[model samples]
Target: MSDEPMDAATPAGAEAAGLAPADRPIFFIHTPKTGGNTVISHFLAFLPVEQVFPPPPQLTLLDGDFATARERLPGLRFLHGHVRVTLTGLLPLERLRLVTFVRHPVRLVASHYLYFRHMPELPMHQAAKALGIADFLRRYPSYGTNPQTRYLTLALGLRRPGVHQEVSEQALAALEHFDFVGVTERMQDSLTALSEHYALPNFPPARLNEGKASRDEVEATEAVLRRDEFLMRLGADFLLRREAEERLEKWFATRRAAQARGALLQGLKGAAAMPWVAARAGDAALSFLEGWHPQGWVGEPRDGAQYWWTEDRARIVLASASGRGLRIGMHVVETLGFDPARIRVILGNRLLKTETAPAEPGAEVSFRIDAATFARHRRTAVIELAGPRSATFAELDPATADHRLRSFAVRRFTIEPLED
Candidate 1:
C-alpha cells in the first residue's frame, strides 16, 4: 500500500523541503532596529504586497487589530510586525514558520536611543534628549535594558519588560524554537541564507532607519544589556555551527531531532536526552555542554588535583547510563566574595538539591540519581549548579586587576555507582 498525502494540509517547514509554500506561511518577528526594514524590502520582491499584513506605512505597529486580522490570515502569504512573541498563540503555529533578526546589543541599544531622541513624535523622545545615554538607560530600563530579549521572550509571560539582566535557561530554550534567527551585523549573508532556506529569490539588500553613535555612547549603553549580549553570542555561535552542517538532509534531521528532544523535555519537565560526547578519556569525570558562559577555566592539575570555575552557571555531564543508580558529589572550594553562598542543583528543569556552601574550602554537595532516572535520560546525566550571587575580584578588592564576575569554584567532582 502506498503512503502519500491525498490532499492534507502540508506539515510545517514543508516549503523548505520543496513542498508548496502556501501551506507553511512565513511569520517574520521583526525585532526593532535590527535592519528589519531592509528585510521587508527583500520580501516585497517575491511576496505580493496584497498578501502581507499591515503593509509598509504601518510597519512599526506593535498592537494591531488581531481579532479582525485572523479573518485575513488564511489568505496572507507573509506577515511581519514589531509585535510580541505571544502572537504564536493566536496563529496556527503548526503551519507557521517563524523567523527573526537580532543585532549586537550595543549597536541595537545605541541606535534605539538615537532614534528615540530624534523622533519628536515618539513618547520617549523628550526624555531621551534630556539625558545622557547612561541616565536614559537607568531611567527607562524597561525600554533600554534588553528590548530584543524582551520581544523574543514575551510569550513566556514574564512579569515585565527586561526583567532579567542575565540570560535564563527558559529564554535560551525559547530561542531554539525559531525556524531562522539572523544577526543584523551580517545582514547580507543572513538574508542570503534566509532566501535559500525558504526557496525565495535573493534580492540586493536595502538600508533603512540607519544611525550611528560614538564609541563612548555605545559602550555606556552596552554595559547594561548583558542578557542581550549573551543571547547574541549564542546566536552567532549557532550560526557558525550551522555553517558546518553542509548536508541539507543531515541538517534537517538534526534540527528536527533537537526540536523533538526540546518538546519532550518541556512536557516531561524532569526528563532529558542529548547525544553525549565524552569530555575526557578516563576517570569517569566529565565537563558540561551547556549553561555556562563561553569563558570558563579548567586549571591545570596541581599536585594531581584539578578545579573548575565559572563566572555564571556551571553544569557537568556524567558518565553514560549504566542502568544502575548513582551518587554524584561536588566539593566547593571558593565563593564569589569569600562569603558563604547558597546554591541549587537542577536536573533537566527539576530542582534536585540545594545547599549552603561554607566560606572555607571542601564543602561537599551531593545528590542521588535512581536507576530509572538514568534510564530515562539515556546516555548521560546533565546536572546544573546555580547561585543567586556573583561578584568580581575587582569589586571586592581595589588592588586586583581581574574584573570578570565570579561565581563559585568546584575543587573536586566524583561519581559513585549505587546498588540496583
Candidate 2:
C-alpha cells in the first residue's frame, strides 16, 4: 500500500478538503465479524467530526437517502454503516468508493457464535430460544444464509424479516460491489491499504473485541456444532468441499508416511502391519478397523468414487482449470425457498439470465458458462431470485433493494487461455 498523500485536487482528498463535498458519501458496507467496527472507528478518528456519519444500526433504510443525512451534517464526507453492497448502484458512482472486509467463513461464523453468546442486547439468544440449534441449523440457509442476514439486518436497524433466502447468497451479492475488499485475517495489512488509498496521515491499530469466546467455547456450544455441520454440508454441496478433501488427504498421507519411517528406524520391522494384526485378534478389532479404514481413505474412496457425481459435487476442479473460453457444468439441485425460474446469474457487471426448473431434492441441475463471461465479469457471480413469491418489500434488509434475493453459494473461478 502506498503512503503518498492524496492532493486536495484528487477525488478523495477533495471530499476531505471540503471543496466539492462528495456527491455520494463514502459508503462503508460493514460485514459482521469482519473487523468493520475497527475500520469505521479508524475512519472516524481521521475524518472531520461533522463529516463522519455514525455507523447505522443493522439494515437501516439509508442506502440512497444520504442527501437527508448530508443536509443535517453538511460536513459529512463519509457514510459508514452496515448495509448490502449492491445498494452502491443507488449512489453516485464517482463520488462513492465502496469498501468492505471478509474473513474465512469458518472463523467468521465461530466468532459470530461467540459474540452472540455474550451480548445480551443482541438477538442471538432470542433467536436461539425461538429456534433451537437443530431447527436453526436446518433453516439457517433460508434465514441467515446470506452474509447480509447474519450481520447487516440486525446491525442497521432493519426490521427482522423472516427467512427469505440462503444467507450465503446475500453475502456473495454484497461483496460484488465493493471497490476495496479487505481480509480480516490480515487486519493490519488491510488497514494499511485503506490508509494509503484514502491518503490518511496514519493508520491506527485496530482494537480487538474482548470477551470473545475461545476455541473451547465453540467446542462447548451446541449451536456452534450445528452451525459447523451446516457449513460443512454446504461446502460439500459447493466447490469448497473438494478443496478441503484434497488437502485433508494430502495431510493424512504425509502423516502416515512419517509414522511409517519412524517405526522403521525404531527397529519395528513389520510395525505398519502389526497394528492390523493386533486389531484383528482382539474384540475391539472390528470397531478399530472400521474407524481406521475410513480414516485411511481420506480422499475420494474407490467405492464412493463410483457414486460421485462431479456435476453436483462441490469440487475445485472447474475453478482450478487454466484457460479462457472454458466451459464447465454445475448442478443446481434444489432451489430451496427460491424459484428456479427467476434465478439470474450476475457475473460482475454482466447479467446472465437463465430459467431453470426445480430438481429432485438431491438431484442436480446443470448450467454452463463460457470463459469470456468468466474473464470479463467474474469478480463474483450471484444467483438472485426476484419476484413477489420470493420476499415481501418489508422482508428485505432495509439497506438492500427490495426486489433482490441472493444465494449464499457463489461460484468463484479464474480464466486463462487454454493450452494448444
Candidate 3:
C-alpha cells in the first residue's frame, strides 16, 4: 500500500532472526497460469540477474543438467521454474525457502487450456485448437488430472497417483511444509502476506497472460480434478492462517507503539504538506506500469528514435496536471497487420477515446485527457491502451528467438499540458 521503496540492506525483522531473506536460497515453484508470471517477475526485480538460476526466457533448470549448473553458479540465491516439487531434492532443502501458488482446479485447467490455444509456441496449442474441451481433457490426462496434487505429491518423491476422491496425506503434508503457498483467488492478500513473510518489496499486482474459457467447457473437467480441488482448499486455508498471523503481528506492533500521539502529529503534518507534494509529483513523465517488457528498447536506435513494444493490453501511468488537461502524442511504427491499428484508450474504467494509427510507419496519433477525469483519479491517471492483437517475432518468422507476445511498436510518446 505504501509507495515508499523498501530498503534491501535492512530487511525488516531479518537481523533479529539471524537470517535475512537474501541469506537463504529461495526456490519458487511456478505452477502455470496461476499468476506465477506476476509473482516471479516482481521477485526477480529485487535480486541480481546472475544470482537467479536459469534466468528469464529459460523457465527451469530441469531443462539442463541442473546439478552441474548449480555447482558452477556459486552465487545462486534464487531458483525458479515450472518444476515439480520432487525435482527440488536436487538442491539443498535445509537452506531453501520454498514458495508456490495454487489456483482453483477448475479455473486453473480452464485458463491453461485457453492459454495453450492462444500461444502457438506451446506444444499443446495444436491439440487445444484441434480438439474440443471434452476431448482435450479426455486425451490429455496429464493436464486434466490433479496437476497441483501431482506436483505437490512429488515433494515426497512419490510417483504421481491417479485422481482420487480425496487428496493424499503425504501430498497434503508436503503442501503444509512450504515456506509460503499463496492462493491466486486472494492474490492481493496473498502478495501482502508474501511480502511480510519474505521481507520483499510489495509490488502492486500485475495481471499478465490472462485468458478466459467458458464455464461449460471448464466445468466438465472438474470431475477428473477432484484431488486438486481438495488441495486448493488446503492452500486457501493455509493462506488465510498466514494472513491472520500477519494481522495479529501488526496489531501487536501498533499496540506497543509508545509514540502514538507523536505519530498522529507527524501524520497530520504530512497530510498538510500533501498539496505541495502532489504539485511536485505532477511533473513526472508517464511510466509503463504493466503489460510492457522491462527492456524498453530492442535492437539499435534509429534517427534518434527509440521504440518500445506494448503487450495486447498495456497500462501507462501519468501524474495529473494542475487545472489543465494533458495533450498526448504517440508514434506507432507497426500495426497488427491492419491498415489502421485500432486503439482503445481508457481512463480508469471510462472509455476516454478511440483512435487509429495509419499503416504507414511512424504514424503519429494524438489524444487529450480532460482535467476533470484527472481530478477524479486524485493526482494520478492510469491510462490503459487496448490494442487489436499481439504476436511474437517467432510467430511471424521461424528463425527468430523472441517469444514475447507484443503489439503496437511505439516509436515515441509525448505529454504536455493543454492550454485552457
Quote each prediction's TM-score. 0.48, 0.41, 0.46
- Per-residue lDDT of 1-420 in model 1, one digit per residue for the tens? 456532121243354356555466687878778888888888887777888876775775355556545678778877777775475446555556777776765667777887887788989999989997767876776555456656666742443333444544434544555677676777777777788788889978755555655666666655654555334433422332233233333345444444543443333333454333323223233455444444333466353254566566665665533446666766777666543336677887798854444424557777777778867876446676776687776888869977766677766656677665
Model 3's alpha-carbon lDDT is 0.61
Q: After superposition, how far is residue 261 of candidate 3 from its true place, in Å?
A: 16
The number of residue pairs in model 2 that clash at the backbone is 24
Off by over 4 Å in 3: 1-22, 63-65, 72-74, 164-166, 212-420
Q: Provide the clashing-pair count of each candidate structure.
A: 0, 24, 0
lDDT of 2 by residue, 138-223 (tens): 65553234343445434432333444433444344333344456666666766766675566755566465454567566665534
Error of 2 at 4 (Å): 36
Q: Which residue pairs does candidate 3 place in steric collision?
A: none
Q: Which runs in model 2 stand beyond 4 Å of their true positions?
A: 1-25, 55-67, 70-74, 84-94, 127-135, 139-144, 148-174, 219-229, 232-420
lDDT of 3 by residue, 97-213 (tens): 677777766667767777787789988899988976557876775666566666665653545565543444544555644667777776777777778676778877654444655
Model 2 score (lDDT)? 0.44
Structure candidate 1, residue pairs in collision: none
Worst 10 residues of 1 by lDDT: 275-284
Which ranges of candidate 1 are over 4 A from the true structure? 1-22, 61-64, 155-166, 212-420
